[model samples]
Target: MVKVLLLITSAVLIILSLLQSGKSEGFTGAFSGSKGLDLFSNSKERGAEKVISNLTLVTGVLYFALVIIAILGQ
Candidate 1:
């Protein structure tokens, strides 16, 4: 049961992470400095973006907790 939950949680985490928008323009613009140091700029996450971001965060925490529980149960 623990293993199944772990797998599901991990899968959800991965999916949520992928669904999020990229903060930067990848290595090309950031390293090239072509975007004028806007890599860490304040890009507001609203609507679906905000929801997905929050879900990703929550799922990450849940996944970590599940991993610890599994380890301790062994």
Candidate 2:
């Protein structure tokens, strides 16, 4: 059923998002205006980080598609 797929996709999305490593410079860095988290940095994801990031992206896309499908089916 569409509802089942929706639930699974949403859960996966949440898990994938949480599994990803933080790119931010933590709470202190935010208020301190630290340059540690350079937005234009050349950092790249490798191995599991890359995999998790990709999975998150794919799951996010799937989540949106399922949402639209559910709404349209109503």
lDDT winner: 2
**Model 1, C-alpha of 27: deviation from truth (Å):** 2.8
TM-score of each: 0.82, 0.85
List runs of model 1 lying over 4 Å from the truth.
35-41
Off by over 4 Å in 2: 36-40
lDDT for 31 (candidate 2)? 78
Q: Model-by-model lDDT, in order? A: 0.87, 0.89
Q: How high is the lDDT of residue 14 in model 2?
A: 88
Per-residue alpha-carbon lDDT of model 1 for 1-74, expressed as tens digits? 98999999999988998898777677787678676457467878899999999998898898899999999999
- TM-score attained by model 1: 0.82
TM-score, candidate 2, is: 0.85
lDDT, candidate 2, residue 63?
A: 87
Cα deviation of 38 in candidate 2 (Å)? 4.2
